[model samples]
Target: MKNDVKIRNEMLSWYDAHARVLPWRSKPSERPDPYYVWLSEVMLQQTTVQAVVPYFEKFISIWPTVHDLASATQDDVLREWAGLGYYSRARNLYKCAQAIVSEHDGIFPNSVKTLKSLSGIGDYTSAAIASIAFDIPSVVIDGNVERVISRLHRIDAPLPDSKTIIREYAQNLFIGDNTDRPSCFAQSLMDLGATICTPKSPKCEICPISKYCVAFEHCDAQVYPKKRKKSKIPEKYGVAYIYVHDGKVGIEKRPEKGMLAGMVGFPTSEWNEDSVDNIDDDMSAYKIRHVFTHFALTLYPQIINQKTYNMIEFKEVDKIGLPTLFKKVWNMIESDL
Candidate 1:
């Protein structure tokens, strides 16, 4: 066998024994469920596997199929997806499920073009669902795969710039096509990258493809996938109002567009750079600090005792969906009550 074939075989063999038993994955010989694959891939974007597992299980338990998910209200979907961050994914997920039912007759599209036409399915997600669920041979490159391929070939370029070459190298693994079960090979690379070829402190000694890895041969495998430094994120200050009346609390649904779209949260003044140190009130003691991908937020939580029309039972506020930012405010105050 050629070197690449040998490496592929080794990877498949390793995957057979050590594949991560995720709720969404199937054994090498079994066919994967497309709905599960699509849902899991969508949830996995900008989320860690460990963090996504429970959410995946919850979603599967609540909405077993695409049709069931499509039937759910957007508010219901966003409620379950509350703490998952990236509220946009939850919105798109609802839209995509409805599209799959309406546009494709509840069957996920097998081709990349058709899949990408859906709400949130893009290049990576489309390729992943196509290959893993439909057994269509395609290159599926994610962050983990990027790291593994960059190190294996010792690509000198930094991320984003190196992604093109990394994907090209990854495509080389699917050389033998369906006869080789390239779908399994795709997952094997994912398993290898996720478990063995990690970003930090890679376990080179136990890696199945170490022999073929250029960076490993040179003793600098961990440094193969280089990255540019990120600029410091800016800071924003805001104040959230926790209005209380007889036995209820005030709540608001954010605008359909902006930072935390469609998610439930306390009403708040617009975020700015000013500090809340001057605005002294008893409820200001519960300060909330949250960090998003673009900026950090410091929220001064003010609990005002006033009757408001849009109110829910204060005791039942925990049942509704609130983003992590507002959840922090609830956590601090809930402890007192």
Candidate 2:
């Protein structure tokens, strides 16, 4: 326990000196804003810092406050979030903002419990907002935190299952009694894990808390935070109808409750588990490919007759909103048309 305190102090001091000057970092005289913290957290999920920086800046520039976000149209919100992927995050972000507007009068909640009640906020996100935005002494355990804790204690259990144990360990090391800087502390741990104590080839020589890191001492820091094996993503095949009539293109809204829900895409059928032999008869044009972290989707781009429409909407493809995945499909059609 004493060692933990020592390590925490060392990490905090190092963080004070070396923390990255990110847009979200609060100035000495400025208080952390829950809205910015929440936005950054949601954008950073399963995304890299470099990839999220521009999007974060753009969002802040456009909305500027929770009330602004709440007032923005859903289409505008989704359009801004288009390239960010994870359409669900964008949808949930709008939902959360609306909830704040309706229930909390556009003010972010201060406690983890209340924050969790908002759409898309889970345990990690709630803790992050509570600690960073409100300085509430809550433990914010992200993937970086998990890595740092697992290495410090030389924990070898597979992650997700080991997350709770690691969170408890971090909770024990909290310096709430000495400082009202939980935000900096949490950010410091994240920076340390990301920059120095990385998952692969950790730079222990430059690490401030390496003296107390159990995994470092044991020469196994690289492998301490073990993870479960990833399951193979099954390949899938589908047909997309890129029907163009006059100067407009046909597009459809995905079902409201599945993958890529509520996003605009070319009309497509349910993906088949097996590779399709041919879609030439049913499609005017077709293409095949795979997406990262998802199954392979073959798009059978078909130019349908104008008389076949019943529920589909037609618009100038460039004028309508489209998710990145479908945007790629549109590009393919543009090359051919």
Model 1, CA-based lDDT: 0.86
Candidate 1 wrong stretches, greater than 4 Å: 175-179, 280-283
lDDT tens digits, residues 192-233, model 1?
888889988899999999999999999999886999879998
**lDDT by residue for model 2 over 25-110, one digit each (tens)?**
78857898889999999999988899999999999999999889999988788778877888889989999999999999888999
> lDDT at 21 for candidate 1?
87
TM-score, cand. 1: 0.95
For all candidates, what are the clash counts? 0, 2
What is the alpha-carbon lDDT of model 2 when measured against the actual structure?
Answer: 0.81
